[model samples]
Target: MTNTMWVRGVEWLAAAAADPRACKREWDHGEGVALLEAGRFWDVLSVPERLGLLTLDLLWRPGLPVPGPTLVDTAAGRVGFLLPPDPSGGWVGSGLRCASRGSWVAVPPPYRPARYLEWLVPPDGSGTLHGPGALEDALQQANGTLAVLAPLCGR
Candidate 1:
């Protein structure tokens, strides 16, 4: 994309927070990440890096649409998927975490590089997000696959 397009995409992503200006201000100060409240714009599905890597591959595989923006929190050893908020809140698993209403997540500018947290898949600025059902299906498939293969080296 042209530089202008990516810049707009970054703005689009930061707007997910209640205070997009504050997020932008944080970035202006050279911070690599900003805290954003979940549920309003999207929910966060956080899982172990191992599961995240496998799940992402499945989501991007041949017939499936690519998953939405995903974050890898290296310091936290977790990967977070940005998903459309689900009012039902049915997600539950051994090592999975779903952050919806009343929760917050640290996110990076989708267009920038960061240390602890980086985007595995950045938002396209169209407001598309990972489908909850699709993500769950991918996670389940990944869980089964991990039993035999060693975890891939994560980003």
Candidate 2:
């Protein structure tokens, strides 16, 4: 990531940590680990649908450099990462109880695409490559595409 993107990511992460609802934790398997979790994290996203997709996509993306998780306090709730039972399998919220973590925790498979991908792509501060925009005008688009997909999905 570019320095600007890294700074932006750090700023966002820091803001997330500051939220009242944020929760922080650490995990170890003879190694060190950290995670962040937020029950109401959707509030941080400009678009809920995009937030869902971006989150799932980031978790599911292949070969991502997995950052050690961390925790932060935030207005909405606590946010932190939990260790996966099998590190290779990635993270999922399948049967995650509001406050449960560790071996007993049930999680979804990693390969499945999230249900929210049909919604608008979240803006990385607003750009075609980062957010959705009209090709001709190149203007940034703000609305989530959920409305368009909802009727089709009969939601």
Candidate 3:
């Protein structure tokens, strides 16, 4: 049952990526709700400040393979996706597991008061941690992330 949900979520991401309309809808649908719930800690931020956080969550579904390695535009800079090591002894690539840990630690670290953005992306594909031009970099990162994950969906 859990596997089915993961696969479905992955499929939804693929569909959203291919269609702009789908992307907009999904961004406000399942993915949006998931992100909002996980990002409870950032509720204090203004709408614009929270855009980056919402965008990052939209592009990456935490533990799901569908939205793997997303690039997020942050006040710092463009950063790739990264997931904290699951205490259970492996990567938490399941939506359930990832969502369960909303305020988990992130590598390269985030600025104060924005710890919720830690799981944005991994360091390998990330740009400067919080340098400059993060949003632009995130667009490119998002394309690359989707391209890589789309193929895997067929399997």
How many residue pairs clash in all the candidates, one count each?
0, 30, 11
Show where candidate 2 strays beyond 4 Å: 19-37, 43-155
- Write one digit per residue (lDDT tens) for candidate 1, span 1-155: 57776787788888877778888877667676888888888898999998998999899987777678898988988989989988777788989899998988887787776678888888778788998888889999998888656556342
Query: How high is the CA lDDT of each candidate model?
Result: 0.84, 0.27, 0.33
Report the Cα lDDT for residue 87, model 1.
77
- Candidate 3, lDDT over the whole model: 0.33
- The residue-by-residue lDDT of candidate 3 on 2-119, one tens digit each, is 5554344334323313343554444345333122221221111112223344446554455633433333335544333333223342222212122222442122212111332433
Q: Is candidate 1 or candidate 2 better by lDDT?
A: 1
Which one is best on lDDT? 1
lDDT of 1: 0.84
Q: Which residue pairs does candidate 1 place in steric collision? A: none
By lDDT, the candidates rank as 1, 3, 2
